[model samples]
Target chain A: MNLTQGTADPRPANPVRVVIVDDHAIFRSGLKADLGPSIHVVGEAATVEQAVAVIAEQRPDVVLLDVHLPGGLGGGGREVIAGSAALLGSTRFLALSVSDAAEDVVAVIRAGARGYVTKTISGAEITDAVFRVAGGDAVFSPRLAGFVLDAFGTAPADIADDELDKLSARELEVMRLIARGYSYKEVAKELFISIKTVETHVSAVLRKLQLSSRHELTKWAAERRLL
Target chain B: MATIPVRPPLARSSDRVIAGVCSGLAVHLGWPVKNVRVGMALATLAGGAGLVFYAWLWIMVPTADEAARRNARRPASPIAPAVSQPSGPGAFAPGIASPAVQAQGAAAADMTAAPLPGPPSAAGASPLRGASGSSTADAGQPEATPWFRFRSMKYGKEILLGCGLLLVAGIMIAQMLGVDVPLGTLIPAAAVLGGASIAWMQLDETRRAGLVDKTKADQAGGWARLAAGLALVVAGVLVMVSGSGSWEQTWLALLSSVAVLGGVVLVLLPWALKFWRDLESERAGRIREMERAEIAAHLHDSVLQTLALIQRRAGNEHDVVRLARAQERELRGWLFQDPGREAGQLSDRIKAAAAEVEDLLGNAVEVVSVGDAAMTEAHEAMVQASREAMFNASRHGGGTVSVYLEASEAQAEIFIKDRGPGFELSDVPEDRLGVRESIIGRMKRHGGTAAILNTGTGTEVRLRLQSAGTDAAEGKP
Candidate 1:
């Protein structure tokens, strides 16, 4: 929002488009009233299901998401929360949860929410989160900040690009198939290549890498971060 | 001292017809898994790369770490190697006979000579012998196929992705041949193919067979992940291949980056997790077996000592028979677990209390309990409560304590009652240690109640817990 307010901003004369995704109608109305005239409220969704629908429909820049309701995940709707997280596109999810349980709190955060705030948060803080989320910044409360940091604190594994480079595109594909434990014939069938082709690839990979066997390929792949 | 550490120039895995020995050599010698894979691809494209290292690594590196870590993980032998006093045996040397185990001599020496860090239990790799690699489904006159599909719930998705890729390839080929095919038809076909592929993975041979270790399987899963990634990469490459019509062609580069990164993440991340998990589980199992072995040895020695003492003390043959009977019961429980395997996995407190009570009596006895269900916090509390009740009943209540618990729908009700002269319900003193501390203490923690209900009909103590089923469902994901 501050970026937009600075007259030197390069964006065309468009408002910061927003979508309200709270289960509570009253709060949505209150949020709209609170933001006043500058921010444009493009859509409203009452549950996670509806939120998804509105997101796909409006392509909203930002969404104020409620963490739980009657069924928790959404309505008893079929388009439910899933493991892939593919369906959640450009629209960022900013959670409003009443729970402080670390597991519940952490789960939603991990599920691609750009911001997570307890229901106890004031409207002012929520507005701040909305602005930050719209600008592509991650937002969380102080306690939650620690949780996020801990969750992502893993040291970046130094993958041996060299080990990865050893595989030809086709051989890499076959190796990946093999590492997935694909049998020679199955891999041959899958690649639309011959069973002999699969065998040849496997043998070559084994000899070239000095892996000893298929299992070492697996171990080496993991250690050098290739698997 | 001034020499460089020379790595092998080529990977052993890249060359072999069955395995990529050459690429493996290349990688070991500071090369790439890709280079090995590609080299193998070309070698397969030609003939096989000379598989010089295939026979070498197979012969050279240890076959399975299974044997290497077995002694380290298992409990030491019962008969102390240092004190070679055999229990009238011929081949029962001071040490066990294992050709692979010169290290056993050192381990045995360390065990007898050094103070044990904790228990007689061995440390790691106890369960390696158990996680045999072959699947049971491949038993009998199995057609030794060279292919083994990684066990995955989302194989259908992978297949679908493959189909999608093929469909796209087909469409592109058709377009090149100047034959028109609608993308609308192709896209849906791809989607269907992806789903079918994932389902195929689920029913694949490796998953259905018992021979494959089910504890670990392929980590990659979920819908359209590979498809999405491949699509992105393809789109990016296409954009770059087409010359920049506009400076906005940078969008193609951005899209390419996302696609490549996403595909790599989806494809590779799961493999990494599975590898780590396999290593962890292997180490854990080896340690567990060693522990069990040590326990078995300890129990054997303890039983022998007790039986000898009982034989010496018994006044008559009849007395000897009775003492022998009791000793037999105790020894059996120690060596082999009861039906449920509970007595074996019991916590120390329960074991200690059982021993203490049996010690108090003229006859030494051990009560063993095993769990058929997951052990949770509430279950542990209940187990502790049972120990307390058993102790109180034998010592003060003057009767055998009978315990029965029924659990359903997350609620557990435990009945701990003794058959002694039932104390008056009202006279149950608030400060009386057993009734006050043991009975009420555990119940209150689990948001439940303990009461001395229906007294004189044997002091019937009923504990009603609403959430004690937590411990019963422990160890489940």
Candidate 2:
């Protein structure tokens, strides 16, 4: 629990606090070292049980989560989030894994993780993702965002079946790109719209589907085999 | 009176009828021959027991000529030396040197000396002699039998034709004498002659046994023989039935003919069926052998080649481990699972392969596929070759290797770009077969093209495979 250094980012009065949950000690320490002082590492846990306990006690602004872990009813990162359901309002979850499998991405996202990025990405990209998730924005790698968009995008028949006809075609398009594992910037670029407009369509799509988050939308689309 | 010398029993050859057992006994026991004959005839008239008894004694007693023949044929017994020594008065009796006397004494001595390994007594000797004699007779009988001899004779066919002519001549002579020949007799005689001819021409036991050794090529011939035999037997029965004077007699003739034919068929059917079954099994065995050869060739082409490649790179521990892991995944999938014929698109497979390679080598591979190409026949080969090229790039290149897949209806092309300091193609040693064989050769065999280029920035391997309706083009810069 080291949180002394926070000098690099002076924009926020309090720096984004992150609890690193990973099964590997070297990876946790490496990620912590790479995050620098701008993102304070308040606590670290190597398993789901420890992750839940630490996240509950620390109530960090964002939890940098690994999708697979040992212990805590075998749910891995999902178990930690489910176990700490109460603190989810205050604390966000950002998934970091070496797997780029679409199933892994959709599974963690469905469990209420704000973003999913592979371990191959640079440390700076991960730091940016954590801050963005801390600020209440969904972050995803370009390909991972495609996975989310594909998983959540409604098929033509499903729109009528799930009563998703309330969403406009533009909003559905935005949702498709976003839920298929594309980042907001990529979705905006793909649709030839601004990032703000992409955000507006995502919120509308979520609202029309009566979903609270993009993660749930992705789970809904995946259940319908849209991806 | 010249004293009749006492000797072993002998049948008198001159007074013999049916081997002269009564005369032999009469001589041996000092009875009158007429009394012996009258007594035998009375006993035979009483029951059949006397006839059997006569037959037994006939076989037991040797004739005077046969006794002389036995004396001539006898191997000089070891006991001859003892008799020659004349240790007893009996041995020194007069005429003892004569062969008949010596043979009689030896036979008596052999009967007494049970431990001696001399020839068995005449009564015991019959069965052993019968067994050996029958075996030789069986071996020689085929050659000596009239049918076989007739068939084998140089002029046998002409002699048979002459016999037919003689029969016809006899019928004509009967006609000239105003003696009517019945059609029924003539038809039956023709049937019997025809059956005999067919059996002689076709039903050779040696040839049939040879057919059993041959393949199914002789199946038609076997059926023809069966049909011919059945027809002949039926014709004979029909002719016999029609020729009979009364309905009861015709039925009796028909029943007897059917019973005889049925017995013949019952004996031969099993052999015919077994021969047919053997031929069928031989054909099935040949087909199975061909299938096995095909499977063996497929294993040699794929799995064995991978195993050989794994062995060749044994010195590179990392490469070996990585290749082993990849091969294990592939082989397990091949052996345990269906070959994913209904799998996802080509892009998905390419991504999956890249991910697998990345996992094995701890490297980063960024797969960016632009189009969705449903997997076709050539897609599998293209994916495999592209995976190999990607693996090569990842192993030798610097920075994250980027795979760009452009799949169109006409063709699908994949380019693997890496930022490493690329070496000239000539710099690769002859022993480095991974690129030449697994990548280039694999693509070539699939009617695809693979090009390795050293650009200013890094190395790029391009693979292109044509789909349906497109002519396969060679590598282009």
Candidate 3:
């Protein structure tokens, strides 16, 4: 759980501002209690409409979002991210859900969520992921890594290099290790690299998953409804 | 087959023709009913003896209803089973004791019993009409008046009657003007018109009923009526053309053409019915899709949120968390999965295996499978080895175990890992067969490879196998 302590800075004087956007009141309160003293709960929302409104009003450093919600075009978390697009630069969204659906994970990411984490994640890890997302770093949980691998992990010679649709060799290694439940620190140690280098590879893969225009990637994602 | 202690008391069966006397006697004597009916008819025709005997039997024997009441009081006599007569229509006696049989008899008596759900005018037009029309061919129930006669009817029936009257009036006026009218041609024409109108009414009735009940039996029954009506129309057409006294050669040609057209309609009728049913099912599916979102919302609001809360509260309690996780997975599968698509092969297997491991060890096992191969011996070995590796990870290497299985057309690979104190394979005792025989040796025997690696902080077991049909790895050994 303290895998990121060495890389992350000490808790600053001003706690990281966060807004919880889950439809469950019990989950929201439980998460708020488990988040410890390092994070400040600014606001909460249970639906897409309220999420957008609260995110805009609070202008929190990070927004913990549930992937499925009740209102706003029925797009759930994606609609919220799209609605709060203006605030994305200042207020990043870190999707926190109990759903492991690839389509939902990819949809929120494509709509500009910085990362996605399942609710099974421990309070310490979630708190760390929030800090990282707020600090403009991509947070890849093991499930998200698996999704990225399914989308981009392929043999090198099979696809032309010009497409840039597949993960790099190093990125593939990072994703596989993560998918195998290795923390970034553990992955770095296994590969004889620094945790910073591991983060860089993961962030690159996340970017490709979000903005790739290659037909193969689009076709692959579309086939699975990940797009 | 088993002989009863007592025979069914002699009584007139509800299934009666001419007071059911002959049929009841035949049933009591276990003789063919047709023999009895014929003998009675012959005796009556010859010397009036059958009439006197019939009158005596009719007075002496109780009706079926009274007999049923008598049996109810006694409770010792076994009710007679329904026996279908070998020859005569409506000769079978339905067992009065069984409610199911009674209800079936009632339904057969009135095929149009179900209330048609639509406009009041349409509903009122046809229940009795359909009953009478179907009864002539279907149930052999006696009718007070012949079904063909125009009777007190409404809506569609009145429209049909009005049209018939108008045609008759025009023909009468033409005849009055001293024109030679072919009345023979008008008769067949009227028959055709009547049959066509009957068929059209049946179609409308079926379409309206389909909206409410949507049961297969109802639709099938409706189609049968429609077919009967259409047959009548075709029969009328054949009669008019074939019965012409003059122009024999022309009549023969027209009859051949009509036969060909009839064959075509017969072939197309089934196809048309199928197309109509497909359109109906598509509309049903669309309606279900609309309701799906509403159901998803309601489930997500209460059940899903509760499961999520349980998982969150049971963070470190592995058993509670695993139970919650399994439930959530099941709930989500129900909520979003389409009706007929196959759940993926290796992924489903791995998830099932993971669930078993979680149940056994109370440790979470995260599994993800990419691509899929046909389930074969090689994939079976992979799953077994994966399960073994996962079991080892949960027992020895603690914390959450992660399993990643990637299957391609040529090969399949699996990685089972756990974050525990790293241990070397050489350090394991020789007595331990779980890793040596089950995980590593199992893959090797299946023309595959396995490796156990120490990841400094944890242990990982990797297994790979070639697809069964593919010979890509055959040349290696």
**Ignoring the other chain, what TM-score does chain B have in each prediction?**
0.34, 0.29, 0.42
| DockQ of candidate 2 relative to the true structure | 0.01
lDDT of 2 by residue, B291-390 (tens): 4576577568777887898899889876765565565445433332211011255666887888776765656676644334556667888888888877
- lDDT, candidate 1, residue A64? 68
lDDT of 2 by residue, A1-227 (tens): 11222312212456889899998899988888888578899999998888888998999999999887888765677777788889877788988875434445455666677767777567876877777667665665545533423323323333442344334556646644443334566556667787766655554443333343433344333432334
Between the candidate structures 1 and 3, which one is better when assessed by TM-score? 3
- Please, what are the lDDT tens digits per residue for candidate 3 over residues A1-227? 11333354534446899999999999999999989687999999999899999988999989999988888877788788889888877888998866544556676887788888888888898888888776677888877776666555444424543345667767877887787788877888889898777877777777787778644245323522445
lDDT of 1 by residue, A80-186 (tens): 22321454555666666643323343445434566566554556556665665565545445334322212211122145323421444565455433322233444
Q: Interface RMSD (Å) of model 2?
A: 44.7
Question: lDDT tens string, model 1, B9-80?
Answer: 232342445444544555566766567557556765553432323444443332233333443343333322
Candidate 3, B86-129: lDDT as tens digits: 10001111211122223323332233333422112212212112
On the 0 to 100 scale, the lDDT of residue A177 in model 1 is 38
Candidate 3 Cα RMSD (Å) = 25.0
TM-score for the B chain of model 2 = 0.29
Native-referenced Cα lDDT, model 2: 0.59
Q: Name the better of 1 and 2 by lDDT.
A: 2
